[model samples]
Target: MTVVAEAPTFLWLEITGRCQLACGHCYADSSPLGDHGTMSAADWRAVIDAAAELGVGMVQLIGGEPTLHPGLAGLVGHALAAGLQVEIYTNLLHVTAALWKVFTLPGVRLATSYTTRPTQPAMRRSRAGRARMPGPARTSPKRSAARYRCVSA
Candidate 1:
């Protein structure tokens, strides 16, 4: 008999532990003041390479908000370059024009966790989510490409 371990279907890369919001129901308790100082692009590159070697087809980029990571675009590009599907979850709080260009990349899936607490009025923090995040960029089997997914959590 022969045995082979099953490869993981997907993996998560937490690029940052900081966020622009302090949502009451946050699973990670992320805040504007949180810190994710040590990890670097090289570190992420290694992880992506490893997963690809193991036949993991997809990777989810998360954070307090992974968008807040300065090298986010490069990171996404690198992952796609490595032939891995990428998904990002963010409030879409502060997306810039340059970042918008990045979101148009072929394998990137952008999901907006546009949230509202019953106690507090809806906060207009996700400038990206509001203006540009209104439709699906496109869709494919390995990854569902959407510019917006109004997720509440």
Candidate 2:
């Protein structure tokens, strides 16, 4: 057999078809009742091992809803323990502060987005003008955003 080389760094996985909301600008077309398929801890362990063996530097665990995965923390911990950099995209609604507490580890990054659509005119203007406006000037301030970066191990 011939030997093959691995890329230095790359995102090897994506759970693109899952999400908690089906918004107008949703890129993945996710919904609450959307397909609930998921990979188990064992499955992720296999993928991690293979990637490690190939010398892949970064291993991203993504999904329709990666936070919804039962093995999320376990898998992240596993990858970090194996010396692979980890990153995830998520809607923070399902992420508890407790969960965030556990995920803070070395070599991990969480990228999240607060998914909110400004329905009203004033709210839209405020949000649209968020770049130039200060925090207090906006109306209908959203507390919990669906997206945020989390570093959980």
Candidate 3:
């Protein structure tokens, strides 16, 4: 007998591998010098189209930092236009104006992680300043419906 597997309802796309900080616990080994993979905007668009065609209801954009991708806004827009819910996992350290706009889109949401253990001395210093920085609370639109998920380690 053959077993059939159902199509995935949720998908994760690692849009980039570049980040501002290097955390020891990072499973992706993401760092300031991480390689931004060769996937182009067109390539990502095609993937988004294919996922939507496959009946994928949601796509989570993750990375060394997803916001570092230059075409992030366009990718999110394309996914939303294709009727796919978009979730972005980021460090909340380098969100640009364009990316902020994408976060306000109807079908979009944001997630971030914070680690109390500063494995790297540089990371410890950086976290000290970041701890005082207002994250999504200060940047998010007052009337935006986007949901935010915060994970701490």
Candidate 4:
């Protein structure tokens, strides 16, 4: 069989590392007291322009939680105007009614993150699923995330 390479269909943009919840397994080490992000709204719009020029058709907003970003709507608008599909990854725990309005556009989706991480062995062994944060210092975030999907789903 012949194999063909496929172009990337989507782009990931980390708008901020700020978040309301401080989970034990957070990849970005994000918390309610998170530091302000460096990029401005103009920077995001510029990036969207570049991504569209590169033929990227979709944009996935990420971070500690993208909803925490003050300029999220402008960023989403830039992507939408650039002819790209927009999706936001977020934990429903922090979404306010005002923030919810930003997601009302066509082809925009909100994926929920409800992952669990147990520090102690007992909690790790919860019937919920096997999250990788349990083992030891050597474990990786990638490994932890692989196991964390069960809760997120």
The candidate scoring highest on lDDT is 3
Better of 3 and 4 by lDDT: 3
Per-residue CA lDDT of model 3 for 65-141, tens digit only, reads: 88888888899999999999999998887577867887999999998865554544444245332432235423434
Q: Write model 2 residue lDDT over 1-153, tens digit each, in one string.
A: 998874667655654455665442344435554554575567768888778777888877666667776667788888878789988777666687756865677787887765234543343354333432334653344322322111121
| Candidate that beats the other on TM-score, 1 or 2, i.e. the better one | 1
Tell me which residue pairs clash in candidate 1.
93-126
Q: Which regions of candidate 3 are displaced past 4 Å?
A: 117-153
For 1-153, candidate 1 gives per-residue lDDT tens digits of 999889997998888888876554455546666677697789988998999898989899888888889888988888899899988887887788998888888988887754445623333233332333223532335322221222322
Which stretches in model 4 have alpha-carbon errors above 4 Å? 1-7, 116-153
Error of 4 at 39 (Å): 1.1
TM-scores of the candidates are: 0.72, 0.62, 0.74, 0.70
Task: Give lDDT tens digits, candidate 4, residues 57-147.
Answer: 9989998778878888888877888999999998866577877787887868888754334444444454422333545533565444444
Query: How do the candidates rank by TM-score, highest first?
Result: 3, 1, 4, 2
Q: Give candidate 1 regions above 4 Å deviation.
A: 1-4, 116-153
* 1 versus 2: better lDDT goes to: 1
Clashes of each: 1, 16, 0, 0
Candidate 4's error at 143, in angstroms? 21
- Looking at model 4, residue 90 earns an lDDT score of 86
Clashing pairs for predicted structure model 3, backbone only: none
- lDDT of model 1 at residue 56? 87
